[model samples]
Target: MAKIVVLGAGLGGVIAAFEIRKSVRPEDDVTVINENAFYQFVPSNPWVLVGWRDREDIIVDLIKPMKKRHIELVVGKAERVEPDQKRVRLTDGREIGYDYLVIATGPELAFNEIEGLGPKGFTQSVCHIDHAVQAHTAFEAFCQDPGPVIVGAVQGASCFGPAYETLMIIETELRRRRIRDRVPMTYVTSEPYIGHLGLDGVGDTKSLLESELRERHIKWITNARVIRAAPGMMTVEELAEDGSVKQLHELPMKFSMMLPAFRGVDAVRDIEGLSNPRGFILTDKHQRNPKFPEIFGIGVCIAIPPIGKTPVPVGVPKTGFMIESMVTATAENLGQILRGEAPSHEATWNAICLADFGDKGVAFVAQPQIPPRNVNWSGSGGWVHTAKVGFEKYFIGKVKAGKSETFYENAVLGLIKTKKIKAH
Candidate 1:
């Protein structure tokens, strides 16, 4: 029986551990190590910042569920990964050996890259629960004295959905409180267009997003690179039509939140041949490290290059569905390994995004996420919100129950069954 070690305990990590549990033999051991006892629903962090959800509502104890799944759980931060030794060193100086390792630590938020843009300043982020709490306090203060607001992801940033989600939720909350008119909001993004979304503009997304922003009176500045940020002001450079010289603009704001470029976690950063310079691990089509077949990575931590270059900097986005597909493929391959067989499969990027637009929302599904793709489609409606909420509930329940594969299979089978029924 093989021993498997998974790191992080985030959505990706927990999902991998649970899937391993479902597939590996009883004698095999699967262990998860994380610094925190509870798993944070990262997507709902925006709601926490907007006061739509509380800190407690998004935090769940991972111990009980992990125990039920018969997986060992270690609550400690990983210090280093000695890949050659097949061991992981903990912050407390303990080391554990494993036959297989899965890196799912997710991306590191590089707030320090931008001057005066972290918790030390007046600006706040919704990247983590703590950040969300601080943002909530900042938003409350803004309510007392409404002013200009800046919200968007920084240059080289990939995760644009959260930035957009946070902006709209803030607008929705401000409108609900009757203070929206008192606040001036602007979206500053590195994308060449407003809706590049790291996939080179998903199917008319640019047009739809531009129209939505105009209709909502939310000003946007694209192809702009943020140089630095202070409490109430930010310096940005607007790309010229020729993309040669940059024209600078200084914008003032009372509140701001910007998603920074992502990098891999510190523990695995220094390991030779283990990660890219940006700290993301390099994995094969099967999600296994090229040098070590037993080692794998998934989610934002894996190094996948940007789709294309735009006037403004944009990194590829690993959306929910995309992340889910990675997890599914990884789990299936690991299962095959446990069964003494070769893994033969590849997972493609199929994005299904539900972008909330205040009271209503926009939904889109683009298979092979990049532009000029097959089966690109979208629709706008209020029911998308309900569907999003339902998906959130379903996702949280799956994590809590430690039924990763079962949940995923049921979801896919249901989709297929629905398609068959419609055909009939």
Candidate 2:
């Protein structure tokens, strides 16, 4: 019997373990390793920062679910990956052997890339539950004495959705508290434009987001590179299309939330031929490392190049739907290998995103996440907000039930023509 190990228990890893259990032989051993015992819904982090949701409200204890599914769970951070020996070393000095390994550790937040940034620094973050809780506390303090606010993603940052959602959500809360008029808000982003979103403007996202920002009286500086951030002050350099600095400004702010760039986790960072220079897992179309065929990667931990060139580096985002697709394909391929058959499954890698902005939101779908695609669509309304809420409930429920796919969820994705895997 093959021993299959899935790393990280975030959205992709948890679902992957469940799918692998369903596809592999009954005797096959499936184990999941994660640093945390609880599965937190990352999409709801923006809500948590605004006091709309609490930390406990969005997390599920993984122990009960893993026990119910008969999957082994190890709560420890991976220290190193011995690809040649097919073993993973945990921080506790225990080594786990596996016949196959799935790497879904997600990105390691690169806050040190910039000075005085991140939760430990001057800026706030909503990327993780802990960060969101801290941001919530900062927001509470800021509300008592509102001032200028800075919100956007830093250069080389790929995850733009949370930056946008957190910005708008903070705005909504300020208005609710009747202190919006007392606060001046500015958006600073690395994207060449407001809605490039690292996918080169998804179906008029440029126009829609620009309109929303204008209606809300929020000013913005595109192609911005944050030089440094100090307490209550951030220096930004606005660049022109030709890569020349157009202007530099020292913006004062009582609160800030700038998303940092991401890199591969420590365990896989120095593994030659397995990761890119940025430390993201290098995988082929089948999500398997060409050098280490026994290893498969999914989620934000995998490297995807930027769609095109911009003044500042902006990596493409791995949305939830796209990551789920990768998880399904990886599980299927691993199952084929266990049966001594050649793997022949590929993930669609399609992008379907719902960015909630408090009362209203924007949703987009790109058939092939990398442009020049068959379908590209986007829309905005209150329904998107409602749909996002429903998604949170449904996804968290799935994690607790130890189920990967559901008929209703599949039907809805079918209506949108999205699939987790495509046989070729």
Instruction: Return the top candidate by TM-score.
Output: 2
Candidate 2 runs further than 4 Å off: 406-424
Each model's lDDT comes to 0.81, 0.90
Please give the distance, in angstroms, between residue 104's alpha carbon in candidate 2 and its true position after superposition: 0.4
lDDT (10s digit) by residue, model 2, range 23-83: 9999999999999998999899999988999999999999998989989999999999899
Per-residue alpha-carbon lDDT of candidate 1 for residues 150-237, written as tens digits (9 for 90 to 100): 9998888999888888888888899999999998899999888888788777667788878778876899888878888886799888
Residue 235's C-alpha lDDT in candidate 2? 96
Q: Estimate each model's TM-score.
A: 0.94, 0.96
Q: Give the root-mean-square deviation of each candidate in angstroms.
A: 2.5, 2.8
